[model samples]
Target: MAQAGTFVFLDYYGRLAIERGFVKPEAEDEDENGEALPSTSGAAKPKVPTISHSAALIEDLTAHKTAALRVELANNPDVALVAVVHAMLLSVAYPYNSEQSALQLTLTPERLEPSMKNAESCKGLSAFNDLADNYGHHLPGNPAELFDWLLEQPQDIVLSLLAFGAAHSVNAVEKKFTDRKKGIEQANQLGRALKVNMPDWFETTGDSYFKHVNRMTIELSLAEARGSEAELSVRAAAKKSEAVTIADRLVAGTGWIPSPLRIAPSEAEQELGAESIAEDEQFPQAAE
Candidate 1:
């Protein structure tokens, strides 16, 4: 019974055998009906199911479909953009009825208020609010008229609205329990394309950065921004709070951006490097 793959059927058959008195229960070790029952303490474990033939076939078929769809979508950027906009609108405007959009993409706009201290007073938030308000003023007051209004709008207007929606959809916030490396990588790609200068938008201070990090991190930041002398100065501060204050004062007006906040290397640079490597391989340099 243990050798068979169907453990459930074995359990059923074992119960039936016990009811008919063919086999005795383990508790009745000294039953006179038959020889002493063997101990079940080292029973054979059930076998785990591997990939089935049907499952493998389905996977192969779906892979072909996925590849074909990807090619079609890549060739039709206009359709892809529209699909993205439609998906985003469904997520933002009709969250409960998001299944209306055919696209499987999900856009969850991160709420920064809960995570960031003094988020309400943030300059970036203020700018975003202004943009939202400007768009809101142009939009229809009635929810029913929104679709018609959007349809009647110029292509540029529609694009502007789409950009706003896409911008809000961006989520680069790192969480404790989840690995969001792929999301962060995509965000960095977007940043590089936009030539984003982080220092222009955000000024790192005790409240924003230093207070959140440990004393060592603060010292390291100072060392990078100023020098080893500045690092030593911060280290002299006995308490972490004192170190944070000293570091903040020293780092101010330095236009120093944290490593995480810095823009990633552009795609063009990566392509150029790859090309250079290929050329180098084709024509090896002669060593002097």
Candidate 2:
């Protein structure tokens, strides 16, 4: 049971009502249309973390500044982004400030309730409560949405105010699952990998694809896999990336996922290539 039923305070408020689980916003509860419907009976309620100092913490993440982040948490532990990140930072805060600055550490989560009542008054609580526990990566809405956007944005976006584990979503990881730009299509190739050992929980409905990957990537992938060869309805236009996606899938299923692409050539590789070229250019001892 939660230590407290849910806090009713100035900065924080809500009733977790864990018995029913976490209910997302009406928008989150909506279907493809703008229409909203009541959830059916006996569905698992999602979990969302509760915390305080939400405004400052979210600002720190949105601003994407590490120093500012450290300061925010240092000044107020309750400002932590999510449980995982909070857990991590708590283990590393300080004695290193040579200047012995005015940092007063507090238990980040201590300031918030595991549950709250009437969350509306809270500034950022609802926006980020889902991220409070280690489960922040599992956003209530389209799970692939934020991560899909992240792929197009600079890598630094990962370090933005999400704090701690906010950036560690399955979707975030899927984007970096393979080499070069192939990572962008990692979701399309996921079914191939999953075929090796399907998850008991996985249900291959249309929504499954949307939950894990962007639309275009999945469509392009299906086109290659089942288009002309299998006569399945191809969903999108042709993409030259078909080969790269296939290769990535093959590599992914083999218990091997390549590391991020190296942008700069290593010194040894540079020298070896040059040496090989030089040797090829040389005549072999006048054929003696």
Query: Number of the top candidate by lDDT?
Result: 1
- How do the residues 163-273 of candidate 1 rate in per-residue lDDT, one tens digit apiece? 987888787877786688898788888887788888998888998899999989999999999999999999999999999899889999999978877877777888999
- How far is each candidate from the true structure, as Cα RMSD in Å? 18.6, 27.4
lDDT of 2 by residue, 34-68 (tens): 57657533456444445656888889776677676
> Candidate 2: where are CA atoms >4 Å away?
1-244, 250-260, 263-269, 281-288
Best by TM-score: 1
TM-score of every candidate relative to the true structure: 0.60, 0.17
